[model samples]
Target: MSLSEVTARMAKAADQAGRSMDDLSLIAVSKVQPNERVASVLDEGHRIFGENKVQEAAAKWPMFRETYENIELHLIGPLQTNKARQAMHLAQAIHTVDRLKLATTIARLAQELGSCPDLFVQVNTGEEPQKSGILPTEADEFIAEVRELDLPLVGLMCIPPVDEEPSLHFALLAKIAARNGLQGLSMGMSGDFERAIALGATHIRVGSAIFGERDYG
Candidate 1:
């Protein structure tokens, strides 16, 4: 689907949900997509994008920013502590902060650099062992711990298990964020974004439908 179509759908979803389009951010997940494809979207005046890897974003966005303006980059994959500093510099927001160790590292980096990117604590709503998020049971304590570090925590993020219904997980994440006073819910993707918006997803990460399927080969 094209960018205009995606925005129109987002508008419809928000209207149906009684939410304003201003409250929603469309993060074009540009991981592994061709430069031409990404550039095409930029040419269409899309300013916000998401990248799965810090290095890929660093390599791509700087060149694009030279030509375009106000490009917002978000890191939406597992963040390595070793690369935390680089990720902070490259992206406007980081959406996979799941561990106290990593959060502590980011806290220290924020002190050293005198600035930090907006952070979203990733929650493993499905309790999937292989997933990179703090368990639901541990979310409250973790959010408190992150707050103590003053890491610019802005919201929460989750990826529902692909085999199950997504609205349940989105609702779960929204519940957690609501109790904690977090306004940002970074959920949803190409498939279930409309459902996510209905459940208060402030940011929807759409990839394949926006840039076409990624060529990982």
Candidate 2:
């Protein structure tokens, strides 16, 4: 689909949810996309883009940085400890902070690097043991722990189970954010974003729907 179509769909979803289009931010998940494709989307007035892997983002961002200084880069995948320094420099927000070690790494790096981006705590809403997130039962304690850090704990992020409806998952994340005074909900992707918006998703990460399926061969 074209960028215009994606924007229209986003606006329509916001309208359906009784939210102004201005209130929501569309984060184009440009994980495996080329820099040219990112530039094309930037031409469409999309300033926020999400990348899922540190290596891919590291390889791609330099090509656009000089030209797209105002664009916001977000890291939306599990981050490794070694990548924290580079991620802090490039990312405007990190959406997959699930462990204290990684958080401490980011905080220490942010202090040394002289920059700290917005931070969102990722919760394992589906309680999938394989996923990279804090467990639901431990979320409150985690939030309290992170509050003392210098990073801005802006909200929570979660990926629902792939096969099930996401409303419950989205609602749970929203509730957690509310209980903790966080203001953003970074839930939902292309397949279930409309439901997520209805359930109070302030930020939606969309990739396939906007850029088409990724060719991973």
Candidate 3:
């Protein structure tokens, strides 16, 4: 689908949910995509994007931001503590502040550098051991911990287990957000974002549906 089609669907879904498309944000996942393909999307005047790796984003986006106006970059992957500085440098939002240590690092770096991006706490709503987010049960305390660190905790994020129902996980994340008084949710993707929209997703990440698939090596 093209950006206009996706935006139209988002508009319809938001209307069905008693919300406006202006209340939603779209992030094009540009991980593993070539620079030319990213440029094509940029050429269409769509700016916000998500990248999974600090290294890859650091390698690519500086030049793009220099050339383009108002580009917003989000770090949407498991962030290593060592790369916290790089992520802070490149992204306008960090969507995987999943642990106390990482939160502490971000808080410290933000204090030192005088710039902090909006932070999202990732919840492992599916309780998948292989995943990087905090367990759902740990969310309240972790969010509190993040607050103690003085990081700008803006919302909750999750990637539900691929085989399970995504709506359940999205609802769980929303519930947790509501309980914590957060208003942002980065829970949907290219495949199930329409459902996510119905459930009040503030941000949805799309890649293949808009840019086509990349067989990442």
lDDT of each: 0.95, 0.87, 0.93
Backbone-clash count (model 1) = 0
Ranking of models by lDDT = 1, 3, 2
Q: Give the 10-residue window scoring lowest on summed lDDT in candidate 2.
A: 1-10
Error of 2 at 157 (Å): 0.2
Candidate 2's TM-score? 0.95
Q: List the candidate numbers ranked by TM-score, top first.
A: 1, 3, 2
For model 3, what is the C-alpha lDDT against the true structure?
0.93
Could you tell me how far off, in angstroms, the CA of residue 159 lies in candidate 3 after the best superposition? 0.2
For model 1, how does the per-residue alpha-carbon lDDT over 1-217 read when each residue is reduced to its tens digit? 9788889999999999999999999999999999999999998989999999988988999999999989999999998899999998888999999999999999999999999999999999999989999999999999999999987999999999999999999999999999999999999999999999999999999999999888989
Compared to the true structure, candidate 1 yields what TM-score? 0.99
Q: Where is model 2 more than 4 Å wrong at Cα?
A: none
lDDT of 2 by residue, 54-103 (tens): 88988888778777768889999999999988898889999999999988
Q: For candidate 3, write residues 97-183 as lDDT tens digits.
A: 888889989999999999999999999999998999999888999999898887788999999899999999999999999999999
Name model 3 segments beyond 4 Å from true: none
**Most accurate candidate by lDDT:** 1
